[model samples]
Target: MDRVLADDLHALHSLVSGLRRDIHAVTAAFSTSWSSGQVEGHVTRVKLLKRMGFGRANLDLLRRRVLRSP
Candidate 1:
């Protein structure tokens, strides 16, 4: 944490500080055999589509987009 915070990159420092819990989760995952990759991929894809459609996308459109996405 100190090393990441000490780095000159502001994005790295901010990301580490802002997503502390996520970082901890990632560290825990690294030592485990189990993976949340599929769930995470689905969530990430949906979030991006939702952001892109924002006000225009209704639930149906979002669902269609999610279904259409690889």
Candidate 2:
């Protein structure tokens, strides 16, 4: 009974190890440079520019203001 339980545990560990390796390979193949940090920075800059514009600038003007200033 003890030997059977140990064998079952060993098989489960092997399966889990294979799954982890497969997941790592998949992530490595499909990752991108555009990460959460970049997205957060863009969102923060947009909000800052919107507040600075005081709700008067049109979309095109606002976009120009944000992109052209810095």
Give the candidate number with the greatest lDDT. Answer: 1
- Residues 1-70 of candidate 1 have per-residue lDDT tens digits of 7888887887788777766858777777788899788999888888999999999878999889889888
Report lDDT (Cα) of residue 56, candidate 1: 87
Candidate 2: tens digits of C-alpha lDDT, residues 1-70: 3454467577677666665669876576569554478779888988888888786877888889778865
Query: What RMSD value applies to candidate 2?
Result: 9.8
Q: lDDT, candidate 1, residue 44?
A: 89
In candidate 2, what residue range of length 10 has the lowest lDDT sum?
Answer: 1-10
Q: TM-scores of all models?
A: 0.51, 0.42
- Give one clash count per candidate, in the order shown: 0, 0
Clash pairs, candidate 1, are none
